[model samples]
Target: MPYADVNGMSLYFEEHGTSEDTVPPLVLLHGGFGAGEMFQPLLAAGLGEGRRVITVDLQAHGRTPDVVGRPMSMEAMADDVAGLVKELGLPAVDVLGYSLGAGTAARLAVQHPDLVHRVVLVSMPARREGWFPGVRAQMDAMHEGAADALKQSPMYELYERLAPRPEDWPVLVEKVASMNRRDYDWTEELSGVTAPVLLVFADADGISPAHMVEFYGLLGGGHKDPGWDGADRPASRLAVIPGATHYDLMFSPLLVPVVRSFL
Candidate 1:
């Protein structure tokens, strides 16, 4: 278990493939209430030779130690990521973050644009006014002794398909419990990202069922500046996996080709 002392916490991470394989390392960030290991399916899908993969467990989750003073703000998470990359001597890397991780990745690309070459944001929430109230309420409910809600959640159904059994339930429960409530903002951070972006989501994903329209609309609205100079904004790609939800699309056979084409 490799660990990096970063941002007042011991961050856990694993490196796969080799830096020699790709020019820029691929940094993988998992979903909310998920550890970096969520990318395992993608890794097994065979992303190709010479593509190094670095998966990180955010602080206080998985094998990482929680930072004592800092709440798990996405900004802090981004800083942790930046520190890890610098500590490991990585020059620049491509970033792939899913769900909550996607939000953090967006912040990173905006705040530390020079450190990222390309970015893939999967199953992210649409940045619309008042869009997060319901979701936040649900998460808050779960945190405030409504743990039973987890059993009825759409995400739980997806998790069941991935890891079924009473024994595995604790892993999922701990993940939800460990999530920091304050780190769920994407409104002000989305516009600052400058990396070539790929947005991937499923049509029926509970968190992002209408994500394609909203996400692509944001990209094309011209209201958002990609933080690039005139005429050189990194291109964006939007892909909606048909007939799949969030959990299903992760291991769905369709995702591989799209990922390979972009990354």
Candidate 2:
């Protein structure tokens, strides 16, 4: 129930783990239409055992109400995260984001390198086109009336249960849909990120395998097989968990160990 007045929004966040833990905190950013609670499976798996875990509800999502005039964008969400870090008086923290949150995390690492120590990007593509054509088409369909159409879905139910203002569901949906319609390319900016990164996705994710490899290559990974001596290994790590998909990877059993190992 804690709210940080940041970046023109009342950003809601929760902290887990003991302050006595030695490891830096990990900030968990959820995907589009998801709240921080979506990471409960990972949290229950002890991802925060030796570290603090910070989870946030991004603009117009979960407990945080949308700013009246500010449209949601990755850049703006990243700024809000940076501001939250500052407000919390932390020097730096590790960031883990999924899908929409992944894009925001990537932008955070690029725009505020000094505030990020490590990054975990889950089910995110480097560019809009990295998603399969049909996936992209599905994303394009999230227009104004999509909220009403999705009322019977779990996402809508979750929002209704958790949002500060359940009546704002349609408004939130419209904002998210509007944001989705915009195109973006973060390839150039991603190349400049200095933090060590871990890219994770399901084998059957929305992103194509070729695009996944391409994304890894941009992160200085997948260029060559690591020598037996481990001398030529890439700083970044790539993990494609079997039997998982974009919508369910967060709850996948394979996610925690991979994330813990990388961090």
Candidate 3:
């Protein structure tokens, strides 16, 4: 029931494990059309041990209501998170983001380097063009008219149950679609990201493996073999969850274990 007035909306958040932490809070950001509840199962499995875990419901998602006339975009969501971090008075925190939230998390780290210590980007592309052509087509196809069709999805059911204004599902769809319409390329921004990062992808993800390696390179990874002395390894790392696709990767048990080990 904790809500922070962030960027003109009531941004809802929940804390788990020890409320206070010297290890820095682990902020979990969910994919597009998902709420923080998406992470509940993993947290319930004890993923938050020894650290404070914070799950945030992004703007217009979950318990948070959409503000009139505000179109959803990566930048906007990132700014909202930055506001939330500042509002909470967290000097620095670790971030784990998936898909839409990944983009937001990356942008937050890029824009406010001092606020983010380490980052984990799951199933997210460095740039909009990193997705497969078919995935791009599907993303671009999202619209309000597709709302009824989307009802068949579990995401829609989650929305139907938890959204403050379930009747505005169509509006949410249109906003996401609108945000997808814009082109975002953060190639340069990512290369200069100061914080150490972990780029995680599924073996059969929407993003190609070639692109995943390229993303790793941007964070100073996969360029050359690290010395056996373990002195020359890049702070950044890459992880691929076998037998998982973007849709199911979030739910994969391996996902939490990898993230828990990393962060």
Candidate 4:
């Protein structure tokens, strides 16, 4: 077990694929209400082969403890992750984040570009507006009162099994709920990102395809055609995995190969 004191809380992280691997480390960030374990399937699929893979448990999620008065916010989580990279003494690392983690990953690439070499954002959009109306409604329903009901969900089960204090489940719920209630839009900032990015989404995702295309446009994509020599292509990519949905894309077998190639 390894822990790092960062940003007023103790953060937990796991390593795979060896420290000696020549490739830059890949930081795997899990979705909201989940832990690093969600990426087990991807890691098993050899995405980490011959590279260092680091999976972090964000604040109040997984093995990381939620401190009193310390609520979970995208900004805080991004800072904590950057602090972890600094603590590890890595000049820069590749980042792959799913859902909530994707938000943090994108923020790092935008606000802390020096710490990120390349980034993969899975099932996430640059703004809350990108999500379908119903999806935003569901997020609004996530209050502390919903914690007990969510216990029937595997997300809760995993938290119970891995949280430093299982009683904090409700706390985590409220914090995330609060964070979600606040509107966010990173679209304006993304164009300034220095690192290359990969935007991956499920074909049947919460984010409409049109919005995703707009997101790509913000990344300087799709405005022009890529010439035969690949000279006009954007530094970023947009990949929508076929026959997948947001609920299951995290474990989609097709996910590993695409991400591995991008990294």
Candidate 5:
């Protein structure tokens, strides 16, 4: 029930775990059309055992109301996150974002390096073209009325349950669809990110394996095997969880360990 007046919006967020000094806090960003509660499984799986976990509902998602004039862009969302971090009085924090959140987190690391210590991206691609052909095609087909079209879906039900203004679901959907239509390629920005990163995705994710490898390469990974004593280890880590897809990757039992190891 906490809201932070940040970046021209009242953003909602929740905190979990004890305030332990040895472990750094983690800022969790959820996927598109989803809220902070989407991470409940991971939260229940002890992701916050030794650390503090903070989950946020981005603009127009979950308990947060839509921003009147701001179109949802990864850059603007990242700025909102940075503003929240500043408001929280944290010098820096580790960030873990999925799908839409992942892209936003990447932007955060690239644009506000001082606010992030490390980052984890799940089911996110550095470039718009990194998504598989079918996925891209599906995205291209989205229109302003998409939310009304999906009113019978479970996502709509969840939105109605959590949105500050449940009737605005259609508006949120339209804004997201509009944002998705915009072209973007953040390969250069990814290369410039100074924080160590963990790239996680499903074996059958929306991104092609080749593109995943290319993304890892840009992050200084996949060039060579780590030598003895791990001297040649890359700062970034990549994990492709078996038998998982974009929709289920976050719920995979394999996710927690991989994330913990990298963090």
Candidate 6:
């Protein structure tokens, strides 16, 4: 129930573990459609004892007040996050972000590199030219309930295959609806980032498998296959999660170890 007023918005946050000197802290930035509590189960399932976790509700989502400025770009969100970290008096913290959150994380690294010790981007898309227009169109059509639109969306297909349940659809729909359609660019910020990054993706993620690979490559991060080759880049790495789709990747058991290794 704790909230910090940042830039005219009430940002809600939850903390876990002990904030002692022995334990380093981790910040969890959810996808645009997700809330701070999305990672709740991970906290209880033994994410280690000495680590502290801070989960936040990004603007206009969950318990946070909507950010009325600049149509919700990743840069704008990153500013809000930076302000929150300062308010909390954290000198530096590791960041773990998924999908939309990944984009925000990239912006944060570029804009405020000093505030982040490490960064992780999961299920992200490339910011290159002409990469995501088709994907965004499909999602828009589905959002408007166009005929067979849902069937056409790779996101919906992946979600069905991975997290299909009567109750899950509503949550998914709500989250997608929360996205600010104007703020979805990350290409400009990727190259300027100097922080160590861990890029993760699922083989079956219909939403952005190809774009993810492209993004991985642009970061000078080396993928096992078909991604950017950064054999010489000392601070970046790419890992593909087998047998997992995008939705499934969120709940995958490997997330902890993957994120922990990077931190």
| Tens-place lDDT digits, model 5, residues 103-213 | 999999998999999899999999989999899888889986777788888788889999989999888888888888788999987998889999998999999999899
Span of 10 residues, lowest total lDDT, candidate 6? 162-171
Clashing pairs in 4: none
In candidate 2 the C-alpha lDDT for residue 20 amounts to 52
What's model 2's overall lDDT?
0.91
TM-score of candidate 2 against the unseen true structure: 0.97
Q: Candidate 5, 175: how far from true, in Å?
A: 1.0
The lowest-lDDT stretch of 10 consecutive residues in candidate 4 is 15-24
Report the number of clashing residue pairs per model. Answer: 1, 0, 0, 0, 0, 1
Candidate 4: regions farther than 4 A off: 19-22
Q: What's the C-alpha lDDT at position 194 in model 5?
A: 81
Q: What C-alpha lDDT does candidate 3 achieve relative to the native structure?
A: 0.89
Query: What is the C-alpha lDDT profile of model 3 across 179-238, one tens digit per residue?
Result: 887788898999999898989999999998889999999999987878899788999889
TM-score of 5: 0.97
The sequence of per-residue lDDT tens digits that candidate 1 reaches over residues 67-179 is: 54455556678889999999899889898888768777887887888899998888776452223456656555555344356668754554455332433444445545545
TM-score of each: 0.76, 0.97, 0.97, 0.97, 0.97, 0.76
Q: How does residue 244 of candidate 2 score in lDDT?
A: 97
Score each candidate by Cα lDDT.
0.70, 0.91, 0.89, 0.90, 0.91, 0.69
RMSD of each: 5.7, 1.1, 1.2, 1.1, 1.0, 6.8
- Which pairs of residues collide in model 5? none
Write down the lDDT that model 6 would get: 0.69
Flag regions of model 3 displaced more than 4 Å: none
| Total clashes for model 2 | 0
Flag the better candidate by TM-score, 1 or 2: 2
Please identify which of the two predictions, 3 or 4, would achieve the higher TM-score against the true structure: 4
